[model samples]
Each structure stands twice: as structure tokens, then as C-alpha cells.
Target: MNNKFGLSNEYTLAKVLQIKHYTRTLFSFKTTRPSKFRFKPGEFVMIGLILRGKFIFRAYSICSPTWHNALEFYSIKVPNGPFTSFLQKITTDSSIIIKTKSTGTLILDSLTPGKRLFLLCTGTGIAPFISIISDPETYIKYNEVIVVLTCRFSQELRYFNYKIKQLLKQPHIESHAKNKLRFYLSTTQEPYPYSGRITWLIKSGTLIADLNTYTLNKRDRFMICGSQQMILDVVNLLKSIGYIEGTINNPQDFVYEKAFVN
Candidate 1:
């Protein structure tokens, strides 16, 4: 396959270690990681496979923390997507291609130090936040971590719910999350206790009321990932409240990335 694509040095082949299906359109898989592949928890890298004798790659956020030996990715299975249709069919031991470079704006370093870190996500946008929360440095940097995930269905929230429970059981993470971590799940099209777009929740003051915390302030930093419209809505709301957009070089009060490029 390497010879066929002429990608011997450009990409590394990783063996699929495990895979789990969360829904017809969503799944997660872990793959062997190259020892030299290092990246911040919230970074994203290009990954793909060969199909019809051609290399097909797509940018995907790394869901696993840097401390983990293997790499994990949460993906949406687009029925006709050139890369995902092929990716979703892989099983254990299947080989995949991962580019060596990883980059993104969602890392903790992109935001100024703050008392609370709010991770706002929708759909598979939860991927990068999974990595951020798993890293110990996140706990060290902020006194509080709040994760808000909104999806269209109740079942879509299952993976995050299960993962958070397991993460909270780990000896090191358990202590930090005991008092600092809060997870909120909401659905848009399905019946759930919390329903509606996150922007609405914020505007209605329902979110802060539920958390029993004061409204966002300068001490509260935010990282947002989701659909384009969702990101725009949230960004506008934050800016209206005086939150400044941040970057790797210029640390500010908030940062964001699109879940998938349209």
C-alpha cells in the first residue's frame, strides 16, 4: 500500500487496536501510535487510508491525551464521505495512515490563565475536549472545568457519559475532578432534561442557574467546538459579554475551532 501511494516517508501506518460503534453515524477507534508522534492534547492531525489505489486523508482531532501510549479518535461516519465511508469499515488489525504533523487552536496554551475553563461542544466536537480534560495540566491550570455537550439524540451523549465516568475513576484524575469538574449534556431533537442550542441556554441564564455559578466573567475562559453556525452564535454571545478571541501567540479569554470543515 505504501508503494502504491508513494507515501513511504510522508505517512506512518498504524494498526487499529480497537473500535466501538456509538451509533450508525458515529464511532471511535484506537490505533497504535508511533513513538515519535507527540502532540498537545487538543491538537488535530491528518489521518486516512488508501482506497482504490489512492491516498485519502482528512483532519481529525486526537481524542486521547498525550500521556496515553495509543491514539484514539472519535469520528462521524458520513455515508458518502470519501474518507469516512472507507474508514468506518475497518476492523481490528486494519492498518490506517496517520500523518506526522499535528496542529490546532484549541490547546490550553491558546487561552490566558483563568479560574474556570468552559469546554462547549456539539456532536463529535467533543473529541478535542476529551483530550483536554484527560490531561493533568488542565487541572493544574484551572480551578474549575465545565464541559457542555449538545447533540441531537440522547444516545449520542452515551459515549461522553461513559468516558467521563471512567475518567473520574482514575486515581489521579479522580481527585482533581471531584471538586472541579462538571459535565452537562443536552439534546436538540430528542427529549432530555436539557434541550436547545447552547447559545439559548446561555442567553436564558438557564445554564448558569443549573450550575449554580455566576454568569461568565473575565475570570472564565472558554473553548468552543461545533458546527459553523453554533460556533458563530457562541462567539458572538461571548464577544457581546466582553470575551476576547485568543490564539497560540496572543492568549486571551476564549478560543474555538470548527468541528468539521464544510
Candidate 2:
């Protein structure tokens, strides 16, 4: 049953704005904006539908930043996903319910200033990191910004690689990013140019080799967004190395968010 507002009680059909294929079944969408809606760079919102007279919802991070009028989302077409099975078929102008408020703690505002910023993401979890990298303020606050993306294979990195290439070409960030933005893509399950899980890379001391950098120290800020186990592991490693969890008011050495449950 659709809400009386002709949408979900907490969200509304914002309209499918755009769809682009990355790999086999993975696709991304941009939707119509909700005038009353507002969110920070790394926040997330529930997106789904009411089906069989029942409401089904799933949390998805907003790939678009608050500056844009429209909401953007990058989703995986799970084989029989309750929502994506239907969502993937949608095209421009199709309606999609979206919540009014976007919320999450994996934002840059939750971390204290540091000389370097490391954003570690896996699969779709890269969504929020995309927003932070695009924001100009990120460059202003930190001297270095490294985005380490771990995926099952290289094809899955195509979409974001294309996007990062485009962002680096932009005049506003091109020159400024010399000492700021960098992308380090890795694949574990399938063969690719870069291989190995991020955890292994860290343990083997190859992460810095890949980035050609020094060791992680208190002067480094970290944001982990990925699978539950991945988050816990990375968080534990950071803490063991002297980093601390942070918040908006009590910004510290690190921040984290689980991309999704398996």
C-alpha cells in the first residue's frame, strides 16, 4: 500500500533521473530532489518500496553531495534483491521513494584535522567516499587524501575509475589535487592489475608502497566504510595503532560506517 502522499510514509517517489551500467548487473541512479530534504556529504538514507501490501526498506548512502539538487545512488542489482530486482529496470523519470533526512556518522565533519586522510571502501561502500573526495573543503583541511577501494574484481572499479578520472580533469581540482587526491584500486577475488585484500596489504606493509608514503601515525585521519567485518577489523587496527573513534563534536583520529550486511 502506497502512503497517502502517494509514496512511502517516510519517503516519496522522487523519480528515476538517470541510470548507468558499470559491470554485469551493477547500475547507478540519480533521482528527482525532495525540496525539504537535506544531508551531509557522507550520510545515508533508506531507499526501497511498499510491496505485497508491506513496506520494504534498505539503507543506501547518497552518492550525491548536499550541494546538488537531485539525489544520486549507486546500487548493486542483487540477483533476487527485494528492491534492486525492480529498481534496476527503471529509467529516467521513473519514481523512487526517498527519505527526507539523510543521516550517518561517516562524514568528514566527524574527524579531527590531520595531515593525511585515508578513505577505505569496498564495493558500493565507495559511494560516501566519492562525495567527500569531490568536496573542495576536503582538500583545504588535509594535505593528502587517499581513496583505497577494494572490490571483487577490476570491472567493478570501472565506474568509479571513470568518475575519478573525470574529477581529476576538472579545472577546479586538477591543480589543487597535486598534493591532495589519489585513488588506489585493489581486487581480491578476481585477477586484476592490483591484487590483494586491503587488510592483507596493510599487514604486508604494501599500502604505503602502493601510495609511496610513510607509516600511519596520529597525524593521519581515517574513515572506514565497508562490510561489517571489514569495519571492525580496520577499526581495531587503527586503535591498536593509536587512532581513536570520533564524532561531530568530539572529532578525533577516525570515523567509520558499515557499507551493508552480507
Candidate 3:
């Protein structure tokens, strides 16, 4: 891909080994890794490929943890989407581009000390939380890690459910997240054990019951990722409950990032 605009910085084409559907169009890919590359969990890198002399680029979160040798990415396959149209056709052994530098503001360091950690996500927004929750640092810093994922169907929940279950089973990590780690799911389109939009769930008190916990407090740190509306709604909820926005320059009670979608 041409980087004439200086938008492309890193060059990588690890072969795709696996792909699976999350929802109708959302999917996840497991790719081969470059041995020399190292990146912080939760950061996003600009990815693109050259096709017919033109390059298409997009930012995707590195969903795998630092400890894993392989790289993982979760994405939405929009019909006729500039990148997704081509990306969805990928299969095992397919090569995809990845930049060298992965950067973002969703890391754990963005928050101050807190006993409760809340990871609020919707759609592909869950990407970063997947990385942070797997990392040992998350459990080491917080007494509890509560992840609330909002999606339209249960299929999209598979990857996250598997990861959370696996992480909870690891003896070394279990102790840190035993009573600490929790997964709260809200399905909007399909009926499951639990169903509704996250905003509705939170407003109607279902979220509290799902979490089996009390309202958010100052000691609780939060991270939100989703669409513009979802982020705004969640932020409003946090504010109504007295949560402050956190940042690297000046730490506060919560952190957030807008998962890019076009």
C-alpha cells in the first residue's frame, strides 16, 4: 500500500489462520504473528492493503494480550464497506496488513487506583477490554473487573465468553479475579437469558441485577467504548452517578474511546 500521505507507518502481513462470524457481519480473525514485534495490549494500529494501485486503511484494535504470540482482531463487515468488503473475504493463510506502532488511550494506566474496574462495551468496542482483561496487570491493580458487553445477538458473545471463562479458570489469575471478574451481557435483538439495550438495562435496574452489584462509586474506575450515542449515554449515566472522566494527563474516575466505524 502507498503511504504518500504518510498515513501508513508499519508494514506487516501475517497470514490469517482462522475467521469466525460474531453477528451477521461482525467477525474475528486469528492471524500469524511476527516474532520481533511487541505491543501493549489494547492499542490500535492502522491497517491497510494495496489493491489495484490504491491503498485502503483503517484502525483496528489488537485484541490479543501481550502474552499471546498470535494477534487477534474483531471487526464489523459492513456491506460495501471500503475495508470490510475486502476484509470479509479473508480466510486461513490470507495475508493482512498491520502497522508497526499500535497506539490508543484505552490502556489501564489511564485510570487511577480503584477497587472496582468496569469495562463497558458495545459491538466491536469490546476489542480493547479483551486485551486488558487478559493481561495480569488488570487483576493486579483492581479487586474486581466487571465487563458489561452490549450486543444484538448471542453469537457475537462467543469469543468474549470463551476468553472470560478461560481466564477465570487459570489458577494464578482466578484468585485475582475470582469474585472480582464478572461479565454482564445485554442482547438487543435476540431473546436470551438477558435481553435489552444497555441504556435501557441500566435505567430499568436490570444491569444492577445482572452485575449483582451496587451503583457505581468514586472508588470504581470505568472504561467505555462503542458508538457515539452509546458512549454519550454511558457517560451520562456515569455522571449522574458521580463518576469523573479520566485521562493520562490528568487522572480521574473513568476512561473512554470511540470505536471507529464508517
Candidate 4:
């Protein structure tokens, strides 16, 4: 199928390898990777399908690690979303289009070396971090890796919880993640052990208290992903503590990216 942008040569056709639905509004799928496709962990690429003869593409963060044989994506099913409404219906062997180039700011290379790495995310924002944490380089670079995931309901966190467990069981990754990895889960609308937005937790010092470790400082690095409002709140909180924004050219204390364009 030809892309609506008329750049067919810039797109690669890939077949869906597997699909798993976690909830009515959430699902994940894996697709065959092109031999020439190469992307760093925590990057995103455009993906879509032809609908009524017109191609519809959306930016999606790749959830699988760079070493993985197939590309994986975790997505939300927006009721009337242009791409998701049809994307949620795709099955194994379904044909989809993946843009040749992948790029994003939420990458390990964008941050300076630090002792501890914190990955803060909400909703599908956990996608990029999934790839980051799964990569062996993450564990080798930092002494501690903490992933804070917050969602409206407990069910929304199931997929990540399961994925982390599976990743821990892997022979190659198990050693690095065993004592170094920490997963913190919280829910806002639903009752959970940890409840409330992460910004509030940081403000109240409860997050630091619960972790029972050193406070945020130059020795620590942070990566954030989520909604615009959430990102704004977290960024403000980090800035107040003297954390600076980072990029590929300017390595700093923290880096972030939007889970989806709003």
C-alpha cells in the first residue's frame, strides 16, 4: 500500500507477529523487524495502516529493547482516534507500515553518567522505559534503576508489571536487574498502596522517604514520559530541585518525551 504522504519508499511493510489485549482501552502488538531497521532504545517511530485507501500514521514508542528480534508497541485504544480505532483490530499476520527512521529524546545517550536512574511514567508512557530498562546497557551504566508507574486504575498497570517480571527472569538480564531494579506502582483514581500523582509524592518527600535512599542530586539521573500536564508538573518539580534538562548534544541530569502527541 502507498502512504498518504506519497513516500512509499521511505516506509517498510512489516507483518504483525503477535497481539495481546490487556484491557478495553489498552493493547500491545509485536511486528516483524526489517533487517535494515535499527533504533536505539527509548525512541519512537511512525506506524500505521491503509484505511479506505488512505494511509494513517501515528507516532508510537517502541517498547522492545534494541536487542529484541521483533519490534513491540504498547498502545491505548482511543474511542475515535484516527489511528488507534483501526489499529486495535489488527491481528497476527496483519500488514502494517513502519516509517524507516526512528527518533526521540528519551534515550540513554542523552544523559550524563549517574549512579541512579529514575524512569517516571504514566499510562502508555511506560512504553519507552520498557525498552530502556530491558537493554543491558541500562543496568551496566547505573547502580540503581527505579521505574515509577502511575495510572488511573490498577488494571492499567498489569501489562507492565507482568513485563518487568518476565524481563527479570531472562538469563542475560536477570543478573543486572535482580537487586538493582525497582518497580514502584501507584494509582490515582483507584485504591492502591501508593496513591496520588508522582509530582505530589516528590513534593511531600514521601517518594524519597519510601525509597529510603539518597535524595535527588547530581548523582542521579531521571527520564520522564507521560501526558503534557503530567510532564509539566514533573519537570517543574525536578527543576525546583536543581535538575536540568538534557539532550543528545547537551548531556544533563534529566531527559523526557511525550508518550503521545496531544
The candidate scoring highest on lDDT is 4
The C-alpha stretches of model 1 lying farther than 4 A from their native spots are: 1-5, 258-262
What lDDT would each prediction earn against the true structure?
Answer: 0.89, 0.81, 0.79, 0.89
> In model 3, where is the ten-residue run with the lowest total lDDT?
1-10
Model 4 segments beyond 4 Å from truth?
A: 1-7, 258-262
Worst 10 residues of 4 by lDDT: 1-10
Provide the TM-score for each candidate, comma-separated: 0.96, 0.91, 0.88, 0.95
Clashes of 1: 0
Q: Estimate the lDDT of model 1.
A: 0.89
The all-Cα superposition gives candidate 1 an RMSD in Å to the true structure of: 1.5
Compute the lDDT of residue 122 as modeled in candidate 1. Answer: 96
Candidate 4 Cα deviation (angstroms), residue 119:
0.1
lDDT of 2 at 182: 81
**Total clashing residue pairs per candidate?**
0, 1, 1, 0
lDDT of 1 by residue, 1-262 (tens): 5566578676888899999999899999999998699999888999978799777888889999788899999999887988888899999969899998788889789899999999999998999999999988899999999999999999999789878987888898788677888888999997899898899999999899988998888899999998888988899999998899999899999999843535
Question: Over the full model, what C-alpha lDDT does candidate 4 score relative to the true structure?
Answer: 0.89
Off by over 4 Å in 3: 1-9, 168-172, 259-262
